[model samples]
Target: ERSGASMAQPETTRVFLNNVDSYASRHIAQVTFEACTDSVKAAALISDVEAELVSNHKRTFQVVGTVSHPSAVERPHRLDRDELLSKLMGCDVVIYNVTQHADQVEEALWAASALHSEVEHFSGPKMFILISTIMTWACSKPADPDDLELPFTDAIFWSRRAHPNFERHIDLEKRVVKMGKTVSLQLFSTYVVAAGLQYGMGEQIFHYFFKKSWLGEDGPVFGDGENIVPTIHIHDLASVVCSVIQHQPRPYYLLAVDDSNNTMEEIVKKIASVLGPGKIQKKPSEDAFLTKDLTDSLLVSLRMEAAYIKKLFSFNWVCQFGLVENIEVVVQEYRQSRGLLPVRLCVLGPPAVGKTTVSKKICEYYRLHHVTVKGTVSDTIARLVSSLLSPPNQSELSTLNRNMNPAGLEEELLLNVMRDELMTHPCKNQGYVLEDFPQTREQAKELFDGKEEDLSCVATEFVLCLEATEAFLLDRVLNLPESRVQEHNCEPENFSRRLAAYNEKQSEDDVVLNYFYEHDIIPLQFGNPNAEADCLPLMQKVIDMVGQPRNYGPSSQEVKEEERRKAGERLRREAQERAEVEQMEADEARARAARWAEWTKKLEQVRQQEEEELEATSRPMRGYLMEQVVPTLSQGLTACCRAQPQDPVDFLAEYLLKNNPFEA
Candidate 1:
């Protein structure tokens, strides 16, 4: 304690925080530099954000905001390019906050490029570009969207062109490296880095929850909120930045998010819970286009691991708070910010593509409510039975009885059943597979009726289209064993005709696929010429494709209680449904019988009409005179021709004698 070499005065280090000043100050000590932003950085100062901003060459830091200016992209007039470049040149580190104005990516990159040009050798400042997870998702796409499931890593997102805003990172990296080996460059693969109660996702979350109230918002959740986004608190982001600053991470890009692998649904639900009880309006990603583009960075989902960065710099999260644990902080911030949040798909495939089986696996993997159209009808019937039984409407209920004619009412019943299934709980609140229903485009269009007063909001998030060869599908559809066969046997000819009809139905469904695709719900085709592999690959792919949802949903006890409540009621309802289905069968039989009888009558009528027409077209025969010529004609005409030409009369007489031309 007494060794007073008069501890050398703490040399102030200049660390540029860009728009991140609010969140970075706590983690870094005294730092010097102005943080230019479109809007003032939320929690830019005196907020809860905390992170260390230290580097190898510098220790103490002083972050001072001296310059006030407009967004360089919008108000280039406000920014004195020369003065800004001078200020940048004086700084030891340049952090370009590209997150605020996506339109300013080029401006930021240009600023970095200018800074790189001004400095060289041992003088160049280290640069960091902060980017979001959507950049990564866009980058991950190949010429073919369907390939192996890949992770959103720093390396991939840094250079990819899925987004132009993200291209700034690539440009900066190239520019910095071009400054020769002395300079360093980094692109941060960030998820939702909380800025403050007012900035970044905090404001969005705040508004989203507040507006949602208890009924939930009218906005849609992207891709059924299945895509996982690696997230971090603002303080964590600053700490990550500071850690990178200190270590001077090299070889370019690094992931900046922590281990909070939350889905949009999870985050929204958590925010909802924190704010107080409320509902989350979940819809398919395709539906998001009603508000946003398919490639909108905020809407794209990216699950990343900061593996390389973590290992390279011994980086770890300094501030620990997660989805559940950070509730208090989130609530406080949300309230402070006046609460908001930008809220956050489908098995569709061709015939015999293991759609149903894959859908089951997808629901299983995601722990969603797996239901089919038929099952939904049963559920609806069960619900209907319960609804009708409590009041005991024997008369009207009998109208729904077996004798009510199922065929005539099936479409109407299904419309109601599907409406309930799609718009009510279980299927409504959670995910479900629509099978064997909406097989045609018209039916699908009916399901999402534009004219309906109360529309169905939720639909299949993903369509797992299973494909197999014609031979395989036919064999599977037709190869029922003799023992398993029934009265109206499926003969080869019938199978051919049915297959042709099936193809025609598929052709009709082309419009359905086109419609869904326009809504960004394209069919994911997985094909197997031979169905020998027992449906395992299809299931695996479904699981792989249907990214895991964050941990939430009805707990085991809740599900059990629901099951218990439905069981007793389901029995009576099942009986009613059975009766209704049987009636449908009977009605269908009668329809067929009627059609057959009408066809028979038409056939007889056609026969009679044809006979009358034939009689009308008939004429008297010139037969009596020609009858004597039969025997003469039967004798070879060639012989008559070959015989020596006789005198016309003598030849006629000889022919008449042989052929009996003269009938008495």
Candidate 2:
């Protein structure tokens, strides 16, 4: 609620808000932070309101309220006139937003009456801001009915008439204005702001159309759809509220609207252009009136101008030209506010190159669904078999089997399953990491129901390709433990066959890679030797390009757990390296000791053999002496012994020669 009360005021400008849960009130609460002064605080009179709406503003604004009234009661405990007046006595501004329902009109008048009764006794300058709907002026005859070019401006608010159904609302507006006029004092003022159909921040009245378009359904346009719809962004309406609070303009009646002259059909078509197939279907005008009263306001035909506001107000305008011209901005607001945007990713890779693993990681990080070809195919086959076995009546069985070729069932079923899987609400809203599906261009076309370039509605935002050399992949499979190899079904022989098929697909002209390329979605190709380490960098690049995530990320506990896991992995790898180094050193030390022992043994053998050779040579000499030289040597020895010595060596040589002569 905008207030004339200033931050400079020593006391807080307490605001009494009714219908706090209404679409307009929620947005109004959000924009309160943008108020010129932080001194204005709100005391919300509890009604049926969304908790999320208030929770978002809790930090910035003090929203005091109790639980909603029980179904048996017309209002909460503070609805008593005396109790309400007591609540109002403490507040400087009373914002009664009656745009939501006919019931709120009565509630607002009661508040107005309470304030009027206490006009003289109020402690400070009190102002009442009434948030009304543009539908009240739906039945007003234009200034020049035939001219048609002239719009209904707020300057001629006195001449305006209310729609028959909204007479109660108009009555309340008059009562609010009358209270201000009767008060006459400068301290009391009342303003009635007739807000147009609001259409931003997930929308309100137009949500049915927005959601239908986003879901790829034909948006329904009531009747000829030629009726002019006056609309305002919720934020802009909030801004008008703020302006009224700060400026307290003299005009008691203000029209909150934009300058767009868009027909109902134009708005839906524009929404479809950005969200879904641009298709619209026209229905009877009565069909719109059949829904809730709030949505029935969409059929209101009003060409409105905020000329009075433009002349009196001086503030920046958001969406002044309105929704059609600023659709891209509005659509983004819708997507982000509701967290409806999906981070669609397709992970492509050869067999055993870690496509599934990488896709799982992506899904975990982004809170996306993991849709693998194998899982989808398996689920589809199971469903088909179960349905066939049960035979849910003959007609369904016939429909299931009709013209179905047993040979081609696998291919056809796979395509259908993948299409349905990706289009599921989980995948559409939260996004999915699809792994190794749509192996060929034809399959991609079938899945998207369009040529690669024409995929506007159901296109994957990113395509990630994980690659490795065929030799490297085969070696990797070979090196895997036997249990792991079995678990992945990638035993060396089987992996080779699958890898060969993948290589063949890569070589083909009609592969899915070409589809992605034609769509101009360049794949993040990760093929380095250390692909495991590259995953984080690849994800970071994608995140940077994609901007913020559409969903919440890992919780603090999850992050800590992941960190611990990584640290554990690092420690294990280090320990393995150390163990390998120690084992190698031990092997080298044992080898060196064995070589030394062998060398020592060989040296001992050589030494012993030399000794033996010496002995043998001596023996041979002794044998020779024993045969012929023995007798001669003995005699030579004896003669040498008897004769002494100087000639002993010569005597031995002569004895040896005598022995040789005997041999000759």
Candidate 3:
């Protein structure tokens, strides 16, 4: 490295400028180059520096022109590749600041190469200085033999091979040197190392670990205790980058600032201390590190050395704060950011009374994630029907018979399925927004019976009691889409009839806070043809109310018990009414049976009397004819012939014989 009086001046002689708010300001002449314009972080840092320079230095700098690239913004008659090259034909120095990715690096190199080639064409030796990161090198892992080759071979190869020992700055250094250009690489280790955990993009590990307490009291640890981590403050990292650009180092530089290195155990212990002391158990060596997948690339042990860069840059940034100092801050901030209040809210309402929609709006307004129950009456019914009719096979016949029999079987099946699904769903951990569930008063009773304690806690913390008019509900039911109608296995024409029955059974007074009026629970009034937007503000208000903190109030257990008592009373009345109806039906059936028995007995007696009369008449006729008719007739005829007188007796006998007709 060359070291002499030239050190007093800024090493590099070129500057890149970006986002000049007002062009008329002092301290601008020194700003020959603009900060990288592509990145949000870079842009923000430059803005801050620009503001500071304008406020304090009051200096103005001239803009030679702006660099043009395909990715940059568009303009009329914008400089083409040839024009851009012509402009930089004899520039003595060039500055590069962009992402540290392999492709980005390659693009930067190409741009610099173009500038240098043009300068050489015009008879000037160009000096180039590049600013980048080592993380990019670590990100470049070798591709598997089976992996397909990408278009940029050099970028792919470098990104893959560069890891624990490879410095991102070193790679840039190697590339610049190969191109015969001066390059300086600046590397910062672990930017923004806070004493406490912070939540950023993706599934934040801290939130995962603390919110769910995945690690219990003790956090996770990986590998042997020999891994070293170099940490830096984000502010420090930005300052160093700016400093390097200002000073313009000769060949290359690496920046790292941290008070000391602590093992994973030490960090975990510090977190535990802030969280209050607890059992800090270590996983057995046989146990594979649980976070291996998450921390594999970013782990300190598997990382390259930041010490060389730290020495070269001579940056004095420090991580003076320990875990205890900021652990609470981090934890509180994470909780606030996630809207994870201690309170739990459970909204109760009739089907299609806007429970789900309201719950969603509440969650959105409060920045809380809302979870819902997996199944409902309609969903369960659909599943049952699907199962019964599936495959169109012999088995389906038996299933159908079992499911569709008896009038009330459908409702029963739906209740059972809903209960099972709710219990099994993943959202049970975070509670849920229930819709079109707890169909019957009995079902609701059963739901809260054994789990009264839990239910009470949930209700007290967050409970919204909902109700609506019968007429409004009837209209809603009628206009429901064909999908919903089919899902419940109901016809559209039958909607009014079904809703009437539902209302009769589970009357509003039975389920709502006041069967007649609204209470503390958010009340949503909807008319015919409900519009979701009409009620969004009310829903949002309820959500905001539930999220606010309150003084220690009544035990959720007590509130739940009161609800349970009321539910039990409602169920008892229903059971009594059901028993009375069953008894009346039995009595009616017995009266019908008695009437039928009386009619059958009278018909039997009539048939017996007719048989007896026929037998009596036949026996008397036979005796009279046999004993008297033959002898009397013979004697009378002989006497009448002897006398030969008035045939009165003969005529009488003939008449009697003709009239009697018992001749057989």
**Highest-scoring model, lDDT:** 2
Residues 1-664, candidate 3: write the lDDT tens digits.
Answer: 3221112222233333221121211112222333311111212222111211111122222234343343444653245567656554433334454321234455556656675444325442344545443343444433444552311122122343334443544455556545542321221111111111112211133333343231223554445534434333333444444444333333233433344344455655555544323334565433434543344222543223343233334333333342234455554444454544344455565555556666666554443334343434345556656676566634534453578644544555544454454443122223345444455445554543324234432322345656678666656656767787576544645655665666676555565333223324443443331335486656555646655532123336767998999899999989999999989888888888888898788888898888998888798887876786855666666656776767767665775566454664
Evaluate all candidate structures by whole-model CA lDDT and list the values in order.
0.50, 0.74, 0.43
In the range 452-517, model 1's lDDT, one tens digit per residue, is: 555634655566555666777667546655543332234566656655765677677365676567
Q: Which runs of model 3 end up more than 4 angstroms from their true locations? A: 3-56, 59-100, 116-169, 175-221, 249-251, 264-297, 302-664
What TM-score does prediction 2 earn?
Answer: 0.55
Is candidate 1 or 3 superior in TM-score? 1
Question: How big is the positional error of residue 106 in model 2, measured in Å on the Cα after superposition?
Answer: 0.9
Of 2 and 3, the candidate ahead on TM-score is 2
Tens digits of per-residue lDDT, candidate 2, 569-604, equal 999999999999999999999999999999999999
Give the better candidate number (1 or 2) by lDDT. Answer: 2
Instruction: Estimate the TM-score for candidate 1.
Output: 0.39
lDDT, residue 450, candidate 3 = 25
Count of backbone clashes for each model? 36, 3, 25
